[model samples]
Target: MKGEPRLAELIASLSLATDLGLGLPQEHVLRQTVIAMRLAEAAGLDHAAQADTFYVSLLAWVGCIADSHELSRWFGDDRQIRADSYQVDKVGLPMMRLMLTHVGADAPPLRRITTIGRFLTGGFRDAVDGFVAHCQTTGDVADRLGMNARVKVALSQAFERWDGKGVPGTAGGEQIEAVMRVVQIADDAEVFCSTGGPDAAGVMLRSRRGSEFDPALVATCLAHSERIFSGLHEVDAWSLVIEACPDLDRPVRLAELDQMLEIFADYADLKSPWYLGHSRAVSALADAAAVEMSCSAADRALVRRAGLVHRLGATGVSTSIWNKPGRLSAAEQERVRQVPYFTERILSRQPTLAGIGSIAGMAFERSDGTGYPRGLRAAAIPVPARILAAAAAYQDLAEERPTRPALPFPQRRAALLADVDAGRLDAAAARAVLAAAGHAVGRRTRLVAGLTAREAEVLELLVRGLANKQIAARLSVTPRTVATHIEHVFTKTGVSTRGAAAMFALRHGLVDAGGTSAERPM
Candidate 1:
């Protein structure tokens, strides 16, 4: 066992994806934690309050991904929508303006009109009130992570208002946790300050003081602006956040780690309806091929997890690109290229999760170096990466995408081999993945004993114990033809018995070695 992962590393990894989900720059959430914890200290919070604030800051948008499919449906790009969100309060006018601008964006004229109609009727209502769902989802992640009840409760209350104007409309003022107020204020401050200066962050905080924020907590944060923001400009966001985690040193149970990763896989798949089962499918194929290729147990685990999370950066890009039916614009393609690099960067931020990032980042790279994010070529990519890439490619061809239908088995095999022959995929790795995907590769396609192609086909069925009548049916030939071919097969092989013919077929590699035997010749 590699022992359990630290609580801090786990949270740091999840928060990296959460940052992308919010459409904020990487480390946005981590930086918020830094600011929030500092605000907690400056406000003279006790140890318990500081701890509560830490959990809330890292997990505030933990459920932000729950409504990604919905966001992408109404607005084209969920990430862009989230980024624009921080610019305006989700109140009357600014919210309506944003909604009006994006209702069925990029859709055809008729589709746009229909989408607008749905929005006016009841769709907009479901969206505006999704806060309760987000809260509950985040709370679920917290509970699965074995967090305390206080952390779960604070998370669910995240969208509530101080004056009772927020979602759920149930909690107000002190009904929401005091620590949550500090974290919420610091969250926006980090985003607002990045574009504006500390002065701008402070101004933004003051603007929302009473109704959206706690007046006292905001006042304390403003009072200690110098100390709170001190050295922040010099520190690395991820390192500072990980180091500051009060629970960073404790190791999580192995089973807990697996469940957490499964949750992340499910979350990644939710980014678009097109991606519904992609991460899990890729993970399963990669894991199986890793075992076939004899990766070390640790590397096997890492490869599987990396496959699950290799698309973490996908959330950073707009779903508009993902859902586009036509060709992408040059600028849009560039955004797509950044996904693997983004995944690598996010995973690298966590000290313990860094190795997995290196492996996951190469999932899209090709042997010919024509792949995106980083055009790693040939041996420049590791074996595990090659396997992951091949596994992902196999699943990609076999699965349907918005832009194309799923390739049939024959086409899938041909596509894979073509990539290998073109020097764009690792030949051995592709073979392993293809075989694992149930696309058998037959090694003996030659005419053994002068058997014709038709005869070879008949011989295979005979060896498998098919009766002459069944063989005739399978080959779509008369029983006389089947019997005549069977006699030719016996005379050519110098064998009269089915058992002897079966032995010959088995000896000639008629059965599966790895891939499906109905495989195309390489």
Candidate 2:
């Protein structure tokens, strides 16, 4: 634990969060990765193909985060949709039926009918668009993490099928990357095997062979089915994947560690469009507030890392709940409160990240024991965790939600102070966070990608899920003018979709991570 952590630990641990997001049991990805590796070995693939298969297996469905917002709109619970998707081949009428079954599942009768009508019109096209978004976002994240080109390319084809039925439908049969083919079988195999045993897994694999799965790989799986799944249920998938890390157990340096953590932050935030940049903003605010509080350098860094991952568990909850425009019912609120616990469980399995996980898990704990998951009182809450709680609160207030617009600085500040009065947040921590936000420093002066100030502003609102008319109204411009600005933004940034543009803004820090200073509040 004292030594630098290996890259495998980081990725393997993050895969746990991916499982939660996909509504699978923890270690589902790890189990699938192990299975994929076994299948790759059994197929007599070369070392390069084997290595690519290893990572592609772990990261295959991670792109699911990219289109969760759209999924939630079409299907009430994105996770449930994914969990159920394993039972069917996601192409043609079967795929369309699965989606229609879940459309507006939790909405009121009128809203549900309206949503169904919308889906009947153009929703399937939007669904295909989501797959495209997933591929690009996954490739971008792989590129940023310094994954090899083969790995990135394999990830880009994650949505493609052997039958040419996948989104983008650019590749089929042998044209699809072999590594992706391996993962396709292993991914669903793990689910079927886990639920109904290896016999069921074998049946499912053979059924989709040459269509959803590569025939050769499926044949290999059937030949070595017993060996491929041997001890899959008995062994600890996390430990197996970490020890068998194809990267030779290489450790990530401190700088690389921070960069990868930032990638995880972006991935977690991508769970919903409304959450775009939320983790980054909270991280920036927490780091700055820790400085204002006179914390030690190590503590400052710890809080910042914690802030970035504090919402990792947020993936466990459905966007239908997170995106709710009105007050939550008692049952819904209870489920949301478990987010921090999920975060802690995801990170705690990785030895080096466990400490950071503990701090992040306390992001919702209140000073007076009113907050959730643990509800520790003031004396038990450490200073850094307290600052994290306050930083997260402040950033949330500053961000636009479906229920309300971004709070003005004065109102946001007053809200924080009011939390202090209500004994929910630390008084000192709230003051430090307010001061840090009011006097935010070291923002990038020159915009990258040649975006004008207004273009950057439009990009921010666009990422926040605002329509052209809403953005125009907010900026006091016509919808056509906003459209022009958006087109310019897309051209300059080299991205054609709002999801990709949001990634650009977040990666380049063009959008405000926190509030701007109108006054130097103490």
Candidate 3:
């Protein structure tokens, strides 16, 4: 584990994409992280407080994607609204004005009026709760990544204002954590300076000194003046922040890998309530289908992890498109297509996770080569990749979408077969995935040559590309036990080596499960 990557590295890799979701350039979060460090020093925050400030600044806005679906539901261009919002203080009348301007800017008159009517009802309450959700979810991610207790608690209060006017305000003034106060200024200051230079940033912070920001911290930042505000444009933002990461970026426990991947799954699904369990469901099906296809244990886990993070790019796409009630224009359709590519680019930055990203990026490829991002042909795709693509399509077809209701399972199942017939999915991969979906599942009901029914099962898994060790793991047996079974299978079936045994099984129809239609999808 000496060269293994740390969890912070994973979080840092996603910092750029988080900025894109906020409608800022990739380095927005990184620059703010550096600025927060400077503010922490000037405020005389202790070592412990400084470390908390580092992560709090980097992740403050990373959870912005969680409200995208709801935000787009209430505002046509959620991304643009957020981008404009950074230009003003989010407290009191300015926040109300911002909401009024964006609520129905592009909607029809009737729709706009109805939106206002709903806003008067309970929609106002929901909007305030969205900020609470942001703070809660961000803390959840930090917790999942094993951050310190102080970081998690301060993060949960990130939106609490000095004047106690913020979401779920439980404390204010000095009671508000210093790290949150420092980050609030750093977060807004970066936006003003990057877009309007230091003078505009200075003026903006000065105006909100006590109401929206801690006055002392704001003064400290302004005092540093040239040291903190200058050269932001000249420095290498990404490398600087990575180097400045808190000293807690140590190697993760191997057992924590799935938990880390689950963090990605949770973060991606947070884009909308509609995506509630979308990634987890797909990951489960893909894992089961990998087992059905006898994919190696390593490959099975990899494919499942791919299913979880395949939608990482969904962060960059607006919820306007994801929650649209009707068809999309060509331009909108093109935007939806880049999601997987974004996922790949983000994951590829961390070398340890590059394999998962490689496979996850192909979750939409077609056998006929009509998929977006890359039109990979059938033979060009691997079995695990093909299973993932098929599984995701199946699940999406069975789930509700913005433009349509959930298709009946019969109809969804028919659509999957149609894709196989139309060359969009491989036949064997389709059947195996269908079996995983409970289409026609059963062990070999008959013997092959002189082999027992169970011996035939082992041979089928072998032919489908499992190694002895993987097969043993899947069966909960030792490799030596599997070796004994394989020898008996070879002698009984008049075959040696895995390929020949597989051919014999296929030729004899033992691997195809001729006895039962229950799970024989083909």
The weakest ten consecutive residues by lDDT in model 2 span: 513-522
User: Cα lDDT of model 3 overall?
Assistant: 0.76
lDDT of 1 at 150: 83
How much is 368 displaced in model 1, in angstroms?
Answer: 1.4
Better of 1 and 3 by TM-score: 3
How would the candidate models be sorted by TM-score, starting from the highest?
Answer: 2, 3, 1
Top-lDDT structure, candidate number: 2
Local distance difference test scores for all models: 0.75, 0.84, 0.76
The TM-scores of all predictions, comma-separated, are 0.79, 0.93, 0.79
Question: On residues 1-522, what C-alpha lDDT tens digit does candidate 3 reach at each position?
Answer: 753567676777667668767877767888898889988988899988988898888788776765565577678777787788887788778887888778877889999988978875866675776676566557556766778888877887778888888878898898888998999999999999998898889999999989889999989999996788879989987677767777777776655776677667756655644454577678878898888888998889889989988888887778777767678999899988998888887787567678888889999999999986899998888888898999889878756665666667678779999999999998887777778877534443567578886677677666443567877777788999888888899889765544344334433446431121121100
In model 3, which runs have C-alpha deviations exceeding 4 angstroms? 439-522
Taking the tens digit of each residue's C-alpha lDDT, what string does model 2 give over 107-134?
A: 7989989999999898888888887777
The runs of at least 3 residues in candidate 2 whose Cα sits more than 4 Å from the true structure, single-residue gaps closed, are: 441-446, 472-488, 513-522
Q: How accurate is candidate 1 locally (lDDT)?
A: 0.75
lDDT of 1 by residue, 352-415 (tens): 5678778888999999989977788987998888988998888788665657777887898899
What would the TM-score be for candidate 3 when compared with the true structure?
Answer: 0.79
- 1 versus 2: better lDDT goes to: 2
